[model samples]
Target: MNIQMNNIHKSFGTNRVLSGVDFDLREGEVHALMGENGAGKSTLMNILIGLHARDEGIIMIDGKETYFANPKEAERSGIAFIHQELNIWPEMTVLDNLFIGKEMTNKFGWLSTKEMKALAQEQLDRLSVSLPLLSEAGACSVGQQQMIEIAKALMTRARVIVMDEPTAALTEREIQKLFEVIRALKKEGVSIVYISHRMEEIFAICDRITIMRDGRTVDTKDIPETNFDEVVRKMVGRELTERYPSRHPSPGRKVLEVKGLTRQGWFENVNFDVHEGEIVGFSGLMGSGRTEMMRSLFGLDPLDGGEVIMKGHPVRIRKPVDAVKHGIGFITEDRKDEGLILDFSIRENMALTNLFSFSNKGFISGAKEKDFVDTLIKRLQIKTQSAETAAGNLSGGNQQKVVIAKWVGIGPSLLILDEPTRGVDVGAKREIYQLMNELTERGVAIIMVSSELPEVLGMSDRIVVVHEGRIAGELTREEATQENIMTLATGGQ
Candidate 1:
């Protein structure tokens, strides 16, 4: 089947997001879509999936003009989309979630548990995923949940599948498995539209590439006919410089130290020291305890055994407030859940951790809060209509910048960022890298957790690898390599 989108145009109030955009996906081929943040990649995908009705367009399915009023209609037409955000029913079991809306039934209209389980098992097996189908969806790891979402799409017998940043949270091994499944699907003549920011993966897996900018189709090319730099240039409208900035260690006194930090099954015996002005990276595969250790350090989760030494003093951090008072800031990996209050305005979100600074006695000073937010907004170059605009309405990359601004407003001595550039585009990623360099230059100790090996190697002064709740190995910038990190991360030591 071939999916062709012709001259799509959409507008919201005064913003004309998409304009005469055209794209296509051929049978048994993986076509990648690349663009910077706010480039209408998600918008176009939403239109294709029928989440948003385009004001003008012709969508042809198998060379026949088709119109879908909703996602259900699109799904009925053999179209399915796996969004970047996992949409799973956490309270339900994996099997139930997989076949929820499209459940199998017996002649008497009773739920066919055996049939559904068998089908779900087959889907998971095809993906080489080993998680139990009876387990609650929330009990699984982020990467596992992602795979289940993919399986759900496959179960629909979707002829044209759309994957949005499918491997953003997956480990290298899991990504390899997913690539294998994609190849299998292609062999069966399924047309796939892949969306991702990882240039390496795009180059490795895509049969053809489409670049979008400002809601317009910029260019489309065969993978063999184009290079990574050319694709990035088309998406960003400019040449992208070095993604990670060079950092020189200032070597001030130790600011944050963790000794024998243990969180039972999550991580154990994690010991490291971050000195003032140094950027230390925590690199590991998914479920390798990097995020869990960071959560424990920031007092977001309980610690079974360990000690956190802050500025040469052993401190008991029982909660986030304690960590904040100890001059530590944490930017969480899930920004939507933990980083921002979506209903609030951008200024309000930015002033969350530092309300006291803008308060007089028991009441907040409106003038001071405004001044503070305005300064940070200008400094960070946050793209917003106004300071009063809702933070949730911004693009993913802008929202990430808001998260960083929220913490920096409090002026912490140590800052921890997890997957800071996970869904961010190449242009915003450069800005984030520059911001980290600026923070380090100001003598702020930084701890970064990243899944991208190139970023880890290029940004950090030292890298620490964790495997199965234990410290597998540690390497300096000079010694870190993809092979070395993988060997340690997979317990090959």
Candidate 2:
């Protein structure tokens, strides 16, 4: 399959998402789409699959002008899209999710359960995934759910696959497996449109790359012909001096100390301490119990046995409100589900944690709330039309900034951040790192749990490795390296 999109233009109300964009895909080649958030990467692909109509453009597939009426039409034509936000039916079983609309039927129009299970198992086996077909989709981890999405796309036998942020939730081992699958697919004459913010993955796997900025095509070059700095400069339209901002730390008294923290069947006997004005990074594999431990600390999950000490005294955190009242803020990993309310306006979401500060006599002060929201919006450099704009309408990077701003408004002594830059762009990630530096300078302690090893190493003052729900080891900034961190995370001496 060969696809060519020329002069694509799209808009939602007054917001122009794509303007005069050109993208093409050749058979048996992996083409990459690189851009900052809201740079029209996803929007352009959405238009191709008929989720959104292009106001002005020409789409030619195999030298024939074509436009899909809907995603179903595109799927039938061997074009499949694995979206950044997954489309799993949480209430349904994994098997049901994999074959939702394309179930097999017998001669009498009866559903062929045996055939479907066999087919599903075959697809999963190809990807080296082990999942129970009868288990509810909601019970799976984010990484497992990502694999399920990939398997669902492969089940269609798509000739043209558009994968947006496919590796964001995957572990190192799974990513290698996916790269192998991509290689096999290319050998079978399948074309791929890869969209991601990770520069390493883009350069590693993509044959050609297209850069977009502010809803317009910037440039397209062969992957080998372009370098990381050049790609970032083209995408953001400026020079990014540093990927991770440098911070000078001056440690103070201990802000948070966890002793014998145990969550039954999850993490056990975890112990660590984060000092004031320091950033403690939690590094591990996807299911190494890093997120589970953070959830227990934030009161989102129950702790079987543990001691949480804050400011030299033991504290009890039984709920989110309790944690908040104790001057602790948590930014969860799954931001769409746990951190932000999509339907609410930016101001409303930012004020959720600090409502009491803006309230008097059981009545809310709109002026105070607006003032606070405006301040954080400017501080965090969040791009939106206005404070009245719905959070869901913003780009992925802006939504993450909003989630961070929400916690920053609460004036926390200790903040827990999980996967803070999972899907964010390079420019926005630098800004976030700067913000973290500023926060630590103001004497706030941060506990960051991340899957990206580079990020964990670059930003952490102290690194703690988690392996199978236990604290395997801790490394100082001078002692930590990628090899040693991975070794500890995998239970190596």
Candidate 3:
């Protein structure tokens, strides 16, 4: 399962994605692919798996030149790709999703239900996962769905696996389990192409690292030979001074307050208040009801019992429009599904939340829209050729910037950011943090919900821990620590 990609080149129309990129994976070793968004990391992997044809390259597999016709062909050849956006069929049963196209048949040409269940159970057991085979795949949490994808890959007996941002949706416990599985796979002679923006994970698990910048390979080094600062410099082609910007909070009047907020079956009895020029971080493990509570606050979900107070006045927010009308903006966790319209131009997506400001007599003003978009693009340091570019075409980091820009256009007195920097690179992450500081400086209150502990501690003026549909504890900036937060999140005193 050794793979060597030399001088790989690919282009989409006039946009060159990969240029003279070189990557190699040794048998039984975890090789990391590190880069900023739009650096061609994913593009190069897509070429390796036959999703995109390389315009120029030599792909050597086990000392022989090989090119897969398609992903299925690649899988049959012992290469499996578990993408960031999973391919689980929601309505289908877990067993059905596992054996979708490659189902076993009995001697009579009937579906081999018993055999499939046994095999699926075996794979899940190997990964230390517990899931009901007959349950609908959609009912599972994101972390469970992630494990299902891993189990599906393992069922193929793949000698090579490409995992893209695999731990993005996983919790601390699930991530450790995944790491254990990866270690077992490595011992079993499986090679892994680990692609992620998390530097800590890369250094923790990978044996070697390949850094890419602007569609070309910058350098490749052994994990022991390189450090975090060195890898970041090579990825962004600059010295990134700070990972998180410094913030000095000066609290103002209360902007948002929740009293006895209850979302049936999700979260209950939630009580908190966010003041102007303050950053309140919600820290919790996956499915700890943090996101569910945020959704209810933004009026995306029904609150069976609650009181939302804005500026000392209790207001009813039954829908997103109601929240927005009251000067509240929300940036959802899933950027592609909830934050932006992939097919729309940047201008269109940015204007979606502030149509009234950019319209006159019910007709949109292109001039006003362009000016606003340009200003935010410049202010946010969004890397794009034009504001007219489709948001789907932009890299993950730039797309996040666009999402933030759209909310900023509304001039919200309070903003709720859920997983604001989830898949963003180190450089883009700093920019987002700086933007948060700027927003707070302008008297804008912010409620940030995040799974990254370092980010939660670095950016928040105060932290609230959520555990199993309830507020576990609250810690001020001076009192918060990783150990205490984890303790609270796990329901410990």
TM-score of each: 0.96, 0.99, 0.97
Clash-forming residue pairs, model 3: none
Per-prediction RMSD in angstroms? 1.6, 0.9, 1.4
Per-residue lDDT value at 241 in model 3: 87
Best by TM-score: 2
Question: What ranges in model 1 sit over 4 Å off?
Answer: none
Name the regions of candidate 3 deviating beyond 4 angstroms: none
lDDT of each: 0.89, 0.94, 0.92
Clashing pairs in 2: none
For residues 1-493, could you state the per-residue lDDT of candidate 2 as single tens digits?
9999999999999988899999999999999999998898999999999988999999999999999999999999999999988898989999999999999999999999999999999999899989989999999999999999999999999999999999999999999999999999999999999999889999889999999999999999999999999999999899999889987999899999999999989999999999999999999988899999999898999999989999999999988999998889999888888889999999989999899989999999999999999999999889887999999888888999999999999999999999999889998899899999999999999999988999999999999999999999999999999999999999998
92-115: candidate 1 lDDT, tens digit per residue: 998888998999999999999999
Instruction: Quote the positional error of residue 124 for candidate 2 in Å.
Output: 1.2
Worst 10 residues of 2 by lDDT: 330-339
lDDT of 3 by residue, 1-493 (tens): 8999999999988888888999999999999998988888888988888998999989999999999999999999999999877789989999999999999998899999999999999888877778989999988877788888988988899999999889887888888888999998999999999999999999999999999999999999999999999999999889988888888899999999999999889999999999999999999988899999989998999999989999999999999999999999999888877899999999889999988998999999888988999999999888778898999888877888999999999999999999899778888888889889999999999999988999899999999999999999999999999999999999999
